[model samples]
Target: MATPRQDSSPKGFRPAFYRMKDVIRITSLSRPTLYRRIAAGRFPAPVKLGGRASGWSAQALQAWIDNPSGYAAEPTADDPAS
Candidate 1:
């Protein structure tokens, strides 16, 4: 019989997924504003989790929080390097 695979993650290293409420709480932005910014590409987009659920990447959110001025400075795969 084949054994099941184990995650075996180290303590305190698990990634955290923040819901809309959590994002609003941490960023202090209203729901309408948050969604508006997302629509305008001013904020990081959330990943679709299911038909009715979505969440932003915590790492990406953290980066924005860390540096709001140059948050979009880093070129993305679609953006050409300059």
Candidate 2:
């Protein structure tokens, strides 16, 4: 993967969206792992931005990184926490 480009915009002018490659770079996750998490509903879903294009929310991704336990495996009602 190519190195992500540094934001060149002024402090207030940066674009709100990031490409899939950017997302992959930021999360340090392989394509399959990222998609698998999405399929399992453990990660944020990408929004369709344009023709054959999609992107995830930067805020949401950051939040997930900040609190990873929310994505950990959980027991069903029949199972006791241990």
Candidate 3:
């Protein structure tokens, strides 16, 4: 049997998937404002988890948290110019 791979990151650390309510609590942004920023490419877009469910990536949220003013959504392959 092979030993399990170990994560060298902080204990209890894992990629978080934050729901709308959690995101509101974390960023203190209203739903409308959050949507506006996402539309403007000024914030990370939430990923679809399943039917009628979506959430933001912790890494993406961290980028915004680190520099809210300078944060810009990274272009994805879906983007025309990307």
Candidate 4:
């Protein structure tokens, strides 16, 4: 049997994404709160991974975590849904 490999990559190696659960865990924010902030453009918007999947940029989230007060509000898009 093959064993599962752990995350042994070096830092700044590649793009890292945080799913909803990880995002919540890292930010300590509830799901609804996260979504609300996203809608309000007060938080980093998540990237669409596919038709039904989405993820947040780990770098962006880490930056926000490092300096919450200095974080800039995301620009609003022309689309009403955005």
**Cα RMSD, each candidate:** 8.5, 8.3, 8.3, 3.8
Model 3's TM-score against the true structure: 0.78
Q: Better model by lDDT, 1 or 2?
A: 1
Question: Against the true structure, candidate 3 has what lDDT?
Answer: 0.92
* Shift in Å, residue 58, candidate 2: 1.9
Which candidate model has the greater lDDT, 2 or 3? 3
Model 2 C-alpha lDDT per residue in residues 12-75, reported as the tens digit of each score: 6534666779878888888898888876657666778989988876766766678755864333
Candidate 3 ranges beyond 4 A from true positions: 1-15
Cα lDDT, model 3, residue 63: 90
* Candidate 2 segments whose C-alpha is farther than 4 A from its true place: 1-7, 12-14, 72-82
Better of 2 and 4 by lDDT: 4
How does model 2 score by TM-score? 0.66
Location of the lowest summed lDDT over 10 successive residues in candidate 2: 73-82
Segments in model 4 whose C-alpha atoms lie over 4 Å from true places:
1-15, 76-82
Poorest lDDT segment (10 consecutive residues) of candidate 4: 73-82
| Candidate 1, position 30, lDDT | 96
Best of the two (1, 3) by TM-score: 3
Alpha-carbon shift of residue 15 in model 1 (angstroms): 4.4
Predicted model with the maximum TM-score: 3
Q: Residue by residue across 20-81, what tens digits does model 1's lDDT show?
A: 98899889999998888776557787778889988887887898799765666344576455
- How does candidate 4 score on lDDT? 0.80
What's the number of clashes in each of the models? Answer: 0, 0, 0, 0
